[model samples]
Target: MFLSFLYQYRQYLVLGVYVLISVAFMIAKSDRVNVNLKSAAISLISPLQKVVNNVSEASENFWNSIEELKKVKKELVRSREELEKLKGANIEIEELKKENERLKFTLENQKKIEFQTAYAEIIAKDPSNYYSSFIINKGKSQGIKINMPVIAYQGNQKGLVGKIIEVSAGSSKVLPVTGVGSFVGAMMADLRYTGIIKGMGKTSDHVVLEYINKDATINFGDLVVTSGQGGIFPKGIKIGIVLGFQKVKYGLFYKDIKVKPIIDFSQLEDVYVIFKQSEETFYQEGD
Candidate 1:
């Protein structure tokens, strides 16, 4: 019975001894003992504390990277949208500049012309034709009529384009001076010599000036303008410049003068129709 009691009491005896030792150490208050205790606790706990801190820092860094990626993605999308808007704005600005230039050129020519005028845009051309004759976006409703002069602004001067050959309610067909059916009364700019300007048939590259006065002087690079004789075109409209002479019979009163037109039909966009000649107006012609 005594041995059984000793075994049961052995656990109590060991716990009491440990508690008494801890109390003695707390109450001693010796600097050397306190230092030794602190060093022992730190030696055992420091590595465990460092491991916990590393785990916490790694989790924080992972979250921070995810947030930064989100911000960068948002910025990229915004930048792309802004870039598209800027591209569209640039295209619109370019279109406005071209329109402004065209209108300014036409306005300057208007100031120099004396006849009543109406502006018309060239709308279409026959795909089969090569003479650059095309249709204008105006017709009888806009006071356009057959034989009305079509003119365009080129460089600092206005060039003679053609005549209105066919008219509909909304459009008119223009016959360029180079057309085979075209003819105009033209005069030399320097010497006041008169002649008839006519288109060469399909094979010729230049138009011909027929019946120039024999007494009048002709030179290369001479400018020609309308005489306003046939009641068709206004006077002072630019026709073309003399290029060379065509071979003909000697001592004839007229020589075949080749003319180079001033207007560049390849770049043509708009034209002005002279609505009146001298005193006769388009209204009177329509009647």
Candidate 2:
């Protein structure tokens, strides 16, 4: 019985030693297996990581381009708005300048006339085919009457423009110096040679002075003015300058003269109507 019990104890001891050796071997190999698995995972995932980086960079670039485009559009809109504002300002400035010039002309004319003068602004012009005449914004209600002489004021110099032919409640028609049936008794400022200035029925560019004496000594650029002989126009009002003279061999004792008017009818704007202070006295005196 003693021998059997000792043999059994020896068998138990050998079994315990075998189990401990197996556990130690498993612990030692665990570290090497884990290292190999980590290496394989890194190799497989590297390509996918590179692809993700490329996609992220492309997305960032697309957003940057969109931002730049929006900025350009905004700049274009701002520039267009500024240009429109500048154009409006320029138009307003030009209108103001015109108004100022008209006022200055009216004030200077007030000093020259003996009677009360009414200022009229030209509102419309007839078509060129009908000759160069204009309508003014003054009428009988403003003491304007038919046959009233209209003169343009240039600084202190008064230039003869035309006369009112038709009058309305608030407007009048002006027959420019160049219109048909227009005539004025004019004289040379230097020589005092009297002549009848007749319209060419065309433009204020030229007028014809008939019945001028051949020996009047009239030359180019000589100043001509209303002689105030017909009791129609004021004395010393400028008509035009002499352009040329023609001598007809078979004609009577008169020569033909071409004249350029002082006033540019095409540019008529503001004018003053001269109302004679003493109409009866002027006509009766035959001046």
Candidate 3:
């Protein structure tokens, strides 16, 4: 019976023995016993304290890294935004530069004109017949009128462009010299021979100079100009250069002459309208 009781209370007995040893040490008055007890207590707690410090250090480092990453991300976003702004500014600057170049070209050409003229920009074109007709930005409100001769300055030389046919309050329609219905009294620059220059439809690259005297000396590359014979185009305006001449199809008295216009109609952008002429210049014949 005593052995059975010992077995059941064996765990309790061991715990009581440990408690008694701890109390005995507490009650001891010897200096060496006290020192040994303090040493054992410090040894047991040292590893736990080290573990706690390591945990604290690791957590602090993790949080610090997170803060740095946030700062870096913010800076990256700011940099992207600034780059976009710079791109937009650069684009605007390029556009302004192109506008300035166009203005400079217009101003330089305007200086070469001698008559009372108005500067006008080409506002629109006939898609069906590009070189035949077009529209200008100036209109009757700006003193633009029908039959006002339009001319383009190119390569430091002035060339005949067309004339105003229709005028509105804010815009005017122009019939180019290449239009089928157009005609101008033209003369050769060197020979001083005069003829009527006629447009051979929109598709033709050269105008037809009709009623040339068969006996007149005709040459290729002869410069043609307005003769001021009709009451429309002013005299001395460059028209074209002679390309070739052919015998009239059915007549013996005239030559069918082709003249290449001086102005490149495809590249025309700005032009001057001859609103008024000098007093000394006059038309010799009715338009």
Candidate 4:
């Protein structure tokens, strides 16, 4: 009967026995036993604490990496913007440099010229009459007048361009040396052989030095200069270089010498109009 009772209450009996043992242990606890208990508890919890710390550190590291990546990306974008700005600045600098160079070249040419001249720009040029006629950006307002000699600077020497034929308030028309109606009294620079220079238009690409004595020694490369005879152009200004002489098919007392003008009409941009001619050059109104 007792055994049956024990079986029926076995669970409760085991629980009671455990409570009694815990009470006994508490009441009879010693320092060494408590220390051993603490050690065992720490040993069991150490791995779990380490796992938690490792997880926390890993999470912190991931956030730090993300922040570093964002900083790098932002810096890259800023750097790209700065590079583009620098490129624009460089282009502006180059343009300024080119402009400065052009100004310097013009200044150099102006310094070498001796004529009391007015500097003018070629504002209008007709392609059909490119070498024959052009317009300047200065006129009566700038003291420009009809028959004022226009000249260009090239290779450190002044060359005859043409004469102004028409003038307005702020603009003037120039008849170039290559114009059919243009004529200038020219002479050989070294030999003093005098002749007349006559234009044959742009198609000829040259001028004819007429009435040069056939017996005169004509050098192929002799420089032709204004003789200042017709009172139009100043003396010593370069007109052209002698290229060759044309053989007259008929009997003639003069040699037809072909001369290439010193100035390259195709490349003409700026010019100096002799508003106040030298003491030797007297401006005549017509022809």
Candidate 5:
């Protein structure tokens, strides 16, 4: 009997259920208690939401810091490259300054000299040999010839350095005044007494002036200059200074004298070779 009664009320039952759902929804929306329950549920989940947001922001900041570090590293590398370039430029500037100094000195001396000359750089030296003889960078290719007079400007003055004994394609060998076979006709600047300046067999700081007569006054600091007798060297070229005089057993007339070459071979860097002398020089020969 109840089943038969439910069959008859099925349509009403469905309509009543729909009405109940609509009424419950409207009541929840209007009531303050239901609104408070919704607020409480949001409060319970807020801490989790805050933690997730903090993690996201931290990740973003970490990536930004890495990018900043990369930019700084690039800047540092560029700075190092610039510093290296500056260092190279500084070295080039210093080299240019030295070259200017050398050319200036050469030009100043060239004005006072009366003969044609060739500027040559001393390239190689035998330091073990007092540098009495060395090689220059200029040679026959540069109009250099054998027996050409080599002069150097040093100590703020021009002085005779050597003679070109050998010439090659691109270089020349200089027989400096202090060599074993070196010989020059020189005279006392004060007394004008001429003598033969002969080099010792072993390279030495001083050469032997054998033709100085015992009568000629010789002093420890007397300047000696070329006499221009042989026509090989120009007159007024500084030969050396007289250190002392000694009596020898062989020649009683001409005593032995020690003279030092004014050209410091060890410090020789640049030289001028006499390509041609403007005038012929002659010195009176003494017995």
Candidate 6:
């Protein structure tokens, strides 16, 4: 009977204890106590909220900085690329200006000559390693024809380029005097020694002067010029300078002399074609 009474009153005892504690808290009625409790609770939770906010703000700031940095890097790369392109264009313009000045000088000087001169720009060059040939902008339509003499110059300093070998509607092919199949009737300006300048199959950037007299006073640095004997090239046009001389071992009549052409073939660009007024008559005869 006693144990049953204890179990039945157990729930009531717990409730009464809670009610007593609430009465005691109300009787205290101290403002300091209430304030202390609220302060403690706020202190604990405020730190947690502050920590969470700080973490979120830091993550947002980090991502924003990354995006901004990427944009800056991209702009910097583009600016550098543009600068390089401008530099290349500037270089090309400078080269073109220099070449134009050279062409103008040549034209001014050629005006004194009686023959008609036509200016043409070099357009293309052969890609073969064994041959030296180039194409010019003038053709048969411009009065250019086969066997026409090509002259290149820089400020009144004229040199032979080659002769027109093939002609088309608007362009012509030039066989340079240094080409393997090219020949020029040349003479030494100092000694008046005449010979045929022949290409040595294209190597070492040199040509051979054949049929030079063994007794000819050919020396290094002697200027060679076109003799105008074949009526192809004009008289007194510079060809090359003598670099060496070698007499044939068994032949006493002739000697071989090596010549270095005045015109730098590797850097050829614009040239002038000498179209004699006689070409019109020659072509009309064939028609």
TM-score leader: 4
- lDDT tens per residue, model 3, 100-210: 998988687777788989988876666685456877777666888778899998876799998887665556668888888899999888888889999876789999888
For candidate 1, write residues 140-231 as lDDT tens digits: 67888778898988788788888887665566778888777789889888778888889764455678888886656688999999877777
> Residues 39-155, candidate 2, lDDT per residue (tens digit)?
345334434544554586689778987997899789668756865978647655776999998887766567656656788777666657757677777765677777778898655
Compute the lDDT for candidate 3.
0.79
TM-score of each: 0.59, 0.58, 0.60, 0.60, 0.59, 0.59
The 10-residue segment with the lowest total lDDT in model 2: 278-287
Candidate 4: stretches off by over 4 Å: 1-105, 127-131, 249-251, 279-287
Error of 3 at 206 (Å): 0.4
Those runs of model 2 whose alpha carbons end farther than 4 Å from true positions after fitting are: 1-109, 247-249, 280-287
All models: lDDT? 0.75, 0.74, 0.79, 0.80, 0.75, 0.76
RMSD of each: 41.8, 44.3, 41.4, 43.7, 43.0, 38.4
**Candidate 1 ranges with C-alpha deviation above 4 Å:** 1-106, 130-132, 201-205, 249-251, 279-287
* Candidate 5 lDDT by residue in tens digits, 1-287: 99888889999988999999878867787576554453354344434544654687699889988998999899779867875978647655776999999888868888977788898876655456444577777766688777788898886788888787766556667888878778888888888988888877434667877788778867798999988878888888988888877568888578888887787776787899888884433211110
Global CA lDDT computed for model 4: 0.80
Residue lDDT tens for model 6, 209-275: 8889888877799999998767778788898999997556776799989999998887777898887
Alpha-carbon deviation at 164 in model 1, angstroms: 0.7
Q: Candidate 6: worst 10 consecutive residues by lDDT? A: 278-287
Residue 37 lDDT in candidate 3: 51
The regions of model 5 sitting more than 4 angstroms off are: 1-106, 127-131, 201-203, 279-287
